[model samples]
Target chain A: MAYFDYLPHLVLFTIGTLIGLEISYKWHSEPFVKKKIEPVPLILALIGGGLMIFYAPLGLLFIGFVIGMRPGYGIYESVIGILFALILWVTL
Target chain B: MYYPVNFNLIYILLEIITAFIFGGLLLGLHRKVMARIQGRPGPPIVQHLLHTFKFYIKELSIPNTSSMPLYVAIVLAMDAVWILALIVGPILGGSFLIIIMCYAVHKVAEHGIGLASGSPYTKLGSTRAVLSATAEMPLIAVPALVFFKTDTLLLDGIINYQIVNGSLFTQLPLVALAMFVLVLSKTPYSPFGIVWGKDIVSGYKTEHFGVIRGVMMMGEILAFFALLWCFITIFFGGIITAPLAYMVAMTGITVILAFICALTPMVAPYHAVMIQWIFAILAVVNVLLI
Candidate 1:
């Protein structure tokens, strides 16, 4: 029952995050990688954040923080992901 | 449901004109402050206006290095979206609606411009822009949730909510923190300015010049007004009968926020990321409790 309460948010967060991760991964792996830092994880985080907006803004934000823990891209990505998540939660 | 015209052509024209003046002033003020922080008197507040005008009449430099038509088309499309977002503000029920549309359009337009330019700086801007957009998504959402539950997405809804349930800071202190973080990140100040700032040296706008760049600036200011209007509508009043009270209160708050953006040296991107998580946690806890 508790899980059901959070089901929509979680599903949206996961779907968005997964999409974000894949997009970020692809985006970073492109020839553009040599030109810039990795964007895959951050992109994943954004997708996750946006999805979370329609459900529980807070839940998505929490999920965003967790997904932000992926290694190698540094704090900027995590910060951006968290920020994006929060923005969607607050305003959307 | 019947909808009232909160914003219309007259209102939009007024808002756009105000945005132009206000954005120039803010940019100039920001520049001056940044210069003062670095020990110099920046250009006059009206300087941005002159810069913008110069860009308007300047020859549209069609770089043979790229497809001009596609580039122009993209910029136009982006500008149109942003304009639509801005005009919706006075037409919609309240400030939150304006903020959501404005931010959404701003992000899209920024990304479009970035891709269209295809320069290194522009690419960096585009990348940072995506990163910035990714960061702001959640921050914008949380506040809307509070409004949603109260059965209003307009400025009036927020004020009424405040009048009945008290300010958000009272009902949801944690979410308020999240809101602040969102404001900082979206505004791209010192700590959250990884994608913008002097380090990027023009960031996304680096490759742009003349009218293409001018249009982008116009969009940026419109977005800024949208942001300011949202802030006021949520925290203060949208279209208050007591205009003086609304102006005084909003001006005071806006000034404080502006000062914070100017005086504080930016934190590293790493620190910003850490702070984001902290605030996000707080916001979630607040929401769960609610």
Candidate 2:
């Protein structure tokens, strides 16, 4: 099965990303893209990430966070996740 | 698998309206509880609905600094995304993944809202919203978890899976926890609400007012309704047997989330990002183990 079956959704999401860029361009101080925050690249990254998630739900999103997120994965997400997983695994 | 032929468009339309009315009342109740918890006498439970009404009757107010039309277009686009969510989620019983697509688009609309407003505060809000999306990204693991558990990604299929084997909420609760976190993160004033934090003076919406604000509020109401609807359909599939029961579940969830929102202080920006990422990673590892 082709992943692009959900192409309309991808189009709408892209249009939204473009709209955000236009808004940023209009009001941003530097004229093109903001310098300090670098929203353009960030927006591109979001679009890129969204595309990956759409194309492949099984994508390893955890690896990225696992790398930047020290403490051997994550504290709140990991701890609460493990705690709940254990309780449910044992009880259910 | 959709069995769409059985659904009456008019009947579903009426239910959407019913969901809207009840959603507003429940949100008002959310505020009342939050206020009483904080030791202050809150406005009437109907205050939120009244404000939504007032914003419509009141004149439209665009900021002097904002560029023409883009400000208004952003507001309408915000509503459009949720309206799409309403269609796919509650009306059509579309795939679960599409709802996430709508959420991704909504994030962009939110980011644009701050930038289009032309205020420094609004700019900060836009930046914060984008930054906040980073923390929230881990939640994308949710649909993946559901797909793994149910062996199907369609909303109707998942609901049917629950109806037969019992809810995923009980069978694989980690998914529910991730969803609850997503709901809390998206809730109006929850601890994860960094986009509209007080310190930023209304955050991204600092400059949006009057009809513009009202339109945004309407979109928000729809967004809230759609989120709850999806959550109920996804996790508590048993309740769909009774329409009224389904609504009651929505209200019940709102009340529970409201208490959590009221009690928790706003997370610091960096910490909020860190916590969200942590939640996502946890979800991935747990699901992989499962």
Candidate 3:
């Protein structure tokens, strides 16, 4: 199931968030036709990521979300999402 | 004699629908009450809900200059992110951080949305959205004040702490007041609603019409509801467990928000930012000193 251990939170910071920001920056800055992204992958990423939130470590799901979010909308959202989560951990 | 084991699906679906409808109704109620306060008759409380459905049925189009992928994706992102917020929030009792993150995301997404449209109004709307967001940075103290008192950022932890210690708000009144400013910033026609100010012609969504608009409408409703739910549950404690009690409390807050929006005229954009910053800073200072 879901774990709230420091390892997962750290994974969320170093990998999950970085991947999301990178994908978003690339998606928006590059030409849309260069990648020929389809809605199906985006949709699947959403479905999988959402399901994972309930069943897996949240960090993994967010990383998948960033990868699928090539359109760049969730970039800022995902980044802030991790930050808020970190706020609690840092205090601990 | 027994409940089913697959209640998760039912609960998830129910919460999403409940949040959407309640969020829409709250907006409608706010409009009606605000109109009465301003000495004018208002539309029925279902008007906002009706408007959203209407947007879905109309013709949808994309601008020639728009960033095609982003223009399309932003609407979906708006709806998806909020739905995730709904699940991670009231449905599963996830951390308050996830809920707050979703709220913060909505603001930034608005900035991206405006930029994608290639319309001057949306671009300007995006600019203001960013400014207003930064201006409220001091609201961060609300959480800090909360963490200081409850020693936890998880909603469950906070709620449990409140169960034993009483409402954290009793000792953090200034932080609560600062949060009301945040609540004001999101409501339509609010003094702090600079991003969607009249001069901007619907601000970031000016170019987003038809089905896209409908999705965004649902997203907005969902976000509003989730924010309210989290705000109430976190500060007021277990009142959420009682449906009637939660409804009454939420209605009261909505009415207060509507009155404030109705009575206050929209300020100049920069002035709006300055005022929010001032209040946020005052609240932050209060939290620090305490």
Selected candidate, larger TM-score, 1 vs 2: 2
TM-score of each: 0.64, 0.72, 0.73
DockQ for the candidate 3 complex? 0.01
Tens digits of per-residue lDDT, candidate 1, B119-148, equal 777777777777766666767677556664
> Candidate 3's residue-wise lDDT over B98-204, tens digit each?
76777777877898899999999999999999988887666755777788878898877887888888876676777777877887788888999989888889899
Question: Per-candidate TM-score, first chain only?
Answer: 0.44, 0.30, 0.38
DockQ for each candidate?
Answer: 0.01, 0.01, 0.01
The prediction achieving the highest lDDT against the true structure is 3
TM-score of the candidate numbered 2? 0.72
Query: iRMSD per model?
Result: 20.1, 18.4, 16.4
Sort order, TM-score high to low: 3, 2, 1
DockQ, candidate 2, comes to 0.01
What is the TM-score, restricted to chain A, for candidate 1?
Answer: 0.44
TM-score of 3: 0.73
